[model samples]
Target chain A: MSEKQLHEDQFYITGLKENNTSVIQAIYKKFVPKVIQHIKNNNGSEAEAQDVVQEVLITIYQQATEKKLQLTCPFDAYFFLLCKRKWLNELKKSSQKEVTFLNENVSKDESLQEMVFQTETFSEKQALFDLMFQQLGEKCKEVLRLSFVTKSMEEVAVKLGVTYAYVRKKKSLCTGQLTQLIRESVHYQSLKNK
Target chain B: MQEEMYFAFEQYLGNEMNLEDRAAFEKKLLEDTYWKESFELYQQTHQFLKTKFSGETAAFKQNLKQIALENQSNKNSSKIVPMYSKWFAVAATVVLFCSIWFFMQSNEPKYVEYNQHEKAYFTARSEGVAILKEAQDAFNTKAYESAVGYFEQIPQANRNEEINLYYAIALLEVNKFEQAETLLQAIKSGNSVYKEKAIWYLGLSKLKQKDYSSCKQLLEVLPESADDYNKAQEILEKL
Candidate 1:
């Protein structure tokens, strides 16, 4: 990504933290086109490209929101790698016998392939997290995601159109709820017993 | 911490406790092993919840987009109007026709007088430019609503199709659907490069209003060359 694009992504991530849809749209407008082109060049159709782009953006959104993801590499390379790997996985899962030129090109991107390997290895942890989330109440899940993943309490407040105090209180309540849920989870209980 | 203190502990975990209260809470947490253990549990739960919730959010957004796509395709293939009750449709039509009749009867004399009066003339050349400038400035500042408002203020006569396109986009940003539709209607399709965007938004406006059939119809006509054409087609299908 260019410095300008990097700055835009940073601003977008900040907005997402706050739950600002417009900022998210701006970010979408900036990167989605390039990502789509890259996907198409890699043998994916427009629909596939759209899905890949959305997933990549969502991954970025989630990481930035939860981990307070600081970009060490330019977002372009990192984002491209994630999407490329996801597409490759899809192709592999489909059991295609013949490799297309685009697939070959994607395979050639060694850095991206490495990133994918590093990230994909965490599928087990992700599955666990997904189960825990599913057990949470809808409101609790929403509040926690808003607080940790998106990072914009102000935007969340505005979206919810509730007072800042209410947003804070709700977030705390949701976190507490999740904590209770995790404690009661079968996996956690089994781990404790072990 | 007592059960009653859990709420306070929750606040503390979120860093919402006042400075003095936070300091006192931290001290208590450090001094009391039970409180310290509880806090650690809370921290772990919080971290777990964060990851879980993020994953769920990502899934939800992805699902919403998929739904949109599915709906569009369904609309194109079937053209099935989900049945509204006959009685409801009859009642709506009766109310609409009666209201239009009543409006026409009441406004007939006034319409004649208004038509006879000197046509008001105002040059929008300068004003349109100024408003366009303001809209761009507001967009740059991320003041989406303000940008929409300024864009709307540009006179339709003086505004080029490009300006109208931007105006519709601004209205979309602010979720002002009716205004966007009105502006979009005035811009001729053949000359405007943004015709596809206009059709897409028009369909979206109808979708927002739950006028699924109209949305499907408009979306069906959206040029395949448009950026969102496939997405639009998908939504139309679902509708």
Candidate 2:
């Protein structure tokens, strides 16, 4: 992966990272119509199309900004595949009648399929991590959020009215508890092995 | 692994570990592959939580949502836009019909006499081109054709809104109405510095073209903050 050259369409990823409005507008204008049409023809409305497209863009934005997600395929194929998969998943959740799928070309492209799999996996892991983090107790939650966000054990300790040493130990313990909780979850096991 | 071992990982990461303990930890990591994997997972989780909960996340999400909304509106736009532009886009069309009806009845305060073109003294920031000054001067002096000539020579490569706006106005004056309208439409539809001006000028261009229905629709969308808002309102009232 390191040796693989980034596709020119990496501009879309960089554009998303920089929060360039023009690029965002271009994505919606250029690539979103087929996603909308696919959704609308298959048990969806204009409103649902809006939500799916927004969610897909947000996922890409999150991965791009947080994980430094790099695109090695054409953005159109990668983005369309993500939207298509997400909308199909949504349909399954709602238990709607399955409409005939569009874009067989998506699965035919090996590079697009690989890139799409990476983003899907990243999105799933991100969601699972957020869910597992929330299950932590209130004290653990505050300690973890504060430690990670503030990044200063001394400052966190001061804010929490505790000794710096206590903060360090509690910080590690809270995250340790989180790890233990994730390890215990069946969902985590499936995700881990996958 | 014991819970206390996690603190050792944290301490090592925090650069608080003494040399001997650090060396021991490294040896242990190499010796125990499972523990190495767990440590890496913990490290990944730690970094993920840090960024996911950061203060910037909410604002970034909101910005993305707004951009999506604007794009969605642009996509389905025919007579109406969705989201915030909806009310105005529809209202503009409604106002168009009303103004057309009013135009047929009252011959008072004519649209043509109402607008004595304001001498645009504003020197818009454009790429440093010598002819831009002459264009501005020619436009101010009402030498519309020559202004059109100079403004047309300006590089359109950058999609510069200010240049487009001035060029469009010159296009309108030279009776190249269709070209002017297209340029104004592009500028008005996108997020540009000249958006409000583009809308107002589009209305004026339509009015000059004797298409009152189109004129009223465009005029109604000229926000109150626009320079021509009062004039637009007066024209609407008279129509």
Candidate 3:
């Protein structure tokens, strides 16, 4: 996040954040073919390859939005690595048989590795947080949802027909309660240990 | 005790604490590992909630899904066409040769024997942009003039080797000989998967223009690595 220079490919991230059509089309045209080939050569179908590419792009969009991701390497290298890893993981999850992968053109650049690591971690944590958040009580869910969505404590209080102080207290307690729920989960514990 | 601590957590985050209380809270956070971790998790949970409820997430996802669907349909359509036509070409060649093998062997090879160009597939590459779909449709239907018109709409920078090859073929079909040869020569000089195909098409253009000596010269140099080297040799013998 410090003085490391941003690559020229940062336009892809910004275009994703803004949901630019031409940029997305450009990404598909320029980068998706090699990934499809890699997947097809390794006992995967074109449909599976398409899903992997789409899922990776969505994860990248989420990471870019939530974490303000900056690219230090070529987008091609970063994106291909992410898709290849995701496809391999998918293969492992679906089968118990030992899978020998085709020789991949993996980049060993330190910054690219570091960037992939960060994005993967971010996706995992976000998934866990979403799961825990869904387990909160109905009342707590309502309070937190309205508080964040309306983005104003006073408005939320009026909508809920409660006092400002009550909404304020509930917002804090509900968030704290959600955090406590996450901390006590086995998934969170494993993530923290890792 | 826990409620008060959580209250203090909220107050500290909201910037509602006095200077002295804020100082105490900061010191406690530094010294107390459990409190610091809880506070950090609390902040992250808040950020997650903020983003989850934001307007952009749903809109972005919907747009992405739409784009993916369009791309999928385009891929399915474009993929099926070339594969089907290629197999059809092979089958037609087999059927025709089986019925007339003795008669055709003695006659001079006609240009029609080798004119089964694979159908153009530009939609997937163009991704529904520009005039690629129109060009593909026109080329597949043998409307070479219209195909040439649509191909000319593509900007120079957007024209890759495949696009140029297809465009040059359309030009040759419509008898725009000089322009077609110039483009085919440029493609032949460049390094790409389309290079060999470009050379083959250049030879075909010469054949169409009745320059059999030049066509013979071009076909003679078709490398063994080319997919159409056998076809080139067949044409070379007849020429």
Candidate 4:
């Protein structure tokens, strides 16, 4: 990743991570109009287009925060492709009838495809982790939540009325259990296959 | 045993293991794919939890929702801008060039086009001031040189800003730029109805002097509330 040249538009990712208002507004102004038009062309409404754009941005923010997502292609192409794929998937999910999918000339750039894939994978894994987390026992869920949400293990212990050593040990065990549950899921298996 | 392994994973990640134990852990991971994958997943789970609980993520989502709402509402209000077809684009270009052509035909702002100053009215203000009457008549008749001469003869005590404004215009018309600008500057600084007029004339004085850059600079400062603002814009575009 270091060997590949980072595009100058990487500032979009940085702006997103920083949650800068003007940058987000610029993204909406410059790139979102194209995405909205595409979705409108593909049997989607303006409200649905807004949802797809917001979801794509949230996924990008998550990936950047967790995995340091680097952009090699222009942000416009990458962002539009992500929104398009998301809207298509939404169409596929909601339409029980035969829905005609318009296959415009999506970008053929290898790097753009790879970047979109990475973000999608990250989003799927996040969803899987959230689902698996909810399925954990109440004790484990409480321990994990307090462990992460608090500033430190000591704070977790103080909040839960447990000893510091117990909180520290419970944090590891709960995370481990969560990881095992994720790996055993069909979703994780399918993601790995992709 | 599984619980103890997770504890070890935590210690390894936190760098709490001694050198010998750390080396042994690394060797086992190198030799065992199961242990290696488990360790990787454990680390990833830790990162996911960190990001999930982060305040920054929540704040980012809140900001994104706000911005998206604002953008959507603004878009709806404006309605979609029609995608111009090829012919539409060509038509727009033609209109644009036509306006530009007409604009270019209206050449550089001439002093005469804007120099139709209102007729000086001093007949009532100072009934017995003979020289004020002379100044007003000379200015009204466009005898600006003699207007300047008559204005100079008026006593300083009787010479009010209104009279001074007329004197400055006479100076400007007769090409006495330094004295004209000085008097206009004083009235421009004073609080009077003619303040804005003084500013407009100052711009015109610069224009008549063929000082295009300075003229543009002065005209650009004319506020929209001024009566001459639209005229100033026309000169500005040509300049």
Candidate 5:
């Protein structure tokens, strides 16, 4: 796997990481036309296409940073899949009239399929974690938040008026508690099994 | 998980445990796959938090907004201003109708009428004034060959936009089209007083070269504030 050559689309990912406006603009100018046409052909308005494109782009950026996303396929195919998935999800949530894009042919590219699967799982895992984090007790949330933000248990302890030992113990317990909450959740098991 | 075991896991992962304790933790991990999985999740969560909630998140969002702003700026080429007064709105509608009607009546535009170069004059002081004056007078008198020869004599280290502008125009006058186009492209890409003029002349150069499509494209994008925008647009509409 490591013998595989890096795709030229890596330039776009690097550009996104560095927030180069020209590269981002180039991505839109080059790759977005096909996505927009596809949306319009399926009865979506230009406004909806724009919003979908924007959301999909932001997701790519977020996943890139959070998961160190790699492009094993051409960026266009991966981006199209993401936008299509997001639009399909939207169609399901809203009672929007049926979109016919399900019949559209995607390339039989295994690497692309693997990447799409990883991205979808990563997205769900992120959403599940965020939701589960909110379900943590205030104390657990505070300790974990402070420890992560501060990067030092000593500082967190001082900020929260606790002993160094207490901070260390509390940080572990809070993280452990958070993990427990996640493991006990129904979504966590499905995620793990996936 | 027991508090002691969780604390041991934290200390082991955090690298705060003593070497003996670290060995003990490793021994426990080999025996207990559940702890290994738990540690893996803990490390992933740690990484996720670092990315999702770190200081760079704000910058990332800000950059996205900047890109969005840049994207929208292109789409903002045609903007509709709110005309609140009834008379003002009616007047605007009438003007729009008149322009559309006017455009429909016009014949195919040609570039020859708009391609004529205005005479150029330049000034300089100190050591450069002699050659600068010679070039300027030569250019003024339509001796393009001697104008280019004299202009090329000045040492070319500085980023003087005015000099570059004159030099480029001289180059164009003498049929040194490639050199002239290079200078015009530089000026167009730079922040300078001659930027718009460079664009106009670049278009004219292409027009002279009979590259009608690019000439029309460039002329169509000249902003209203540019010196020759109206003429460019006129030539553009005709083309």
Candidate 6:
């Protein structure tokens, strides 16, 4: 498909928010073979490739929902880079061994690299947010953590033994508090100016 | 003005303001310089607080220090140390609580379930093709029951018409001629790539059910170019 056609396809696929299983399955069908080929070329098995592909797709879904991910690169190259990096990470984590192969054509795309880097940076920021969530008072921490982690106001309310309105209030306050903290922190100030 | 602004700020920040109150507060933020300045200050302070308290390492260090001091004080008491170490105890309790919460949450239908055959079955059709490697595996292993089970789980919501054709073949293999016939009929009416096979199977199902006339009617609809067209023609002759 032309790059424009692929972009349109991805837009169509990502627009499907209600019944995502079939859209996700379609994306999986189109991209998974290339991912599998990339992984197998780098000393990974088909099964491992399948697991990595699924993880990459799930990450894309979560990012799209929670962070409102937008596509500026072709979906094929972007997906390929993500799966490749994920497999490399798996290899590093499992055996402490490095496997190198000729760079795939997808990796040569500068925009694809930038997209992958942006996703990785967002993931790191989220991880830091999770880490900082532990510093609040137990009640505040529990409420805020459940709000983001569960993505459900009613469930967070039940868990925190509060009314739903109270939970919502607490979440907004907690998030505002967190943002204020980040703004004041020396690290955050430096990072922001950077 | 500052106090009034603070009250409105608290309400707005807490999401406690009604719609009118919210609109008034936002209007003030947009138009009133004094309210805007205080709101900005409040925003700055809130951001500061969040940064200071978000890291788990800080929490872990405090917890560890408290545990060490408690252990030291109890050294002379001759009491048994807790078998569940303090950190492990906390971790275990958290896990248990989360498990209960998740179990309760799971009362809603799960979209995915993992089983070996189900995985293979999905993988076979994951490409949107009618390849029967999974079905053939099930058949070869005499996992007919599981074969039928897997076949039945294909989501009707999005499957192309080819799936119905495969499902009918699976049903026929499992000796579900009645169900197979219904599926084959649906496929025949649709613009399925498997329309020819559906026709052949419809005839076979009717033959199995001893409905010669209906079988003959279906067999006549098979295209001459179909692989099974001659077989269908022969079956019609027999009927």
- Please tell me how candidate 3 rates in CAPRI terms: acceptable
Pairs in steric clash, model 4: none
Runs of candidate 6 exceeding 4 Å displacement: A1-6, A12-19, A45-48, A89-95, A102-114, A134-138, A145-169, A180-194, B1-239
Candidate 5 Cα outliers beyond 4 Å, as residue runs: A1-3, A40-51, A66-68, B79-239
- Winner of 2 and 5 under DockQ: 2
CAPRI quality level assigned to candidate 2 from its DockQ score:
acceptable
| True-vs-predicted CA distance for residue B59, candidate 4, Å | 0.8
Candidate 4, residues B130-169: lDDT per residue as tens digits? 8788888999999999999999988777778898899999
Candidate 3 on A43-78: residue-level lDDT in tens?
Answer: 788889989988888888888887789999899999
Say which prediction, candidate 3 or candidate 5, comes out ahead on DockQ.
3
Task: Order the numbered candidates by lDDT, best leading.
Answer: 4, 3, 2, 5, 1, 6
Q: What's the CA error at residue A140 for candidate 2, in Å?
A: 0.8
TM-score of each: 0.37, 0.60, 0.58, 0.61, 0.58, 0.41
Candidates by DockQ, descending order: 4, 2, 3, 5, 1, 6
Q: Is candidate 3 or candidate 6 better by DockQ?
A: 3
| DockQ for each numbered candidate | 0.15, 0.37, 0.35, 0.63, 0.28, 0.02
lDDT at position A3, candidate 4: 73
DockQ of 1: 0.15
- Each prediction's Cα lDDT score? 0.62, 0.80, 0.85, 0.89, 0.77, 0.61
lDDT by residue for model 6 over B1-239, one digit each (tens)? 43444445656765777999888778878997856765875654444334334343244334333433443345424344465478678999999999999988654322122011112333454542443455546644757666666566656764556656666666765678888788888888877667877787777667656677777787788889887777676666544
How well does chain A score by TM in each candidate?
Answer: 0.51, 0.86, 0.84, 0.91, 0.81, 0.65
Candidates' RMSD to native: 22.7, 17.8, 19.0, 13.8, 15.6, 23.3
Residue pairs in candidate 5 whose N, alpha carbon or C atoms collide under 3 angstroms: B109-B238
Q: Tell me the tens digit of each residue's lDDT in model 2 across B63-138.
A: 7788777766666575354464868878999999999988875654444564456565445555654677887899
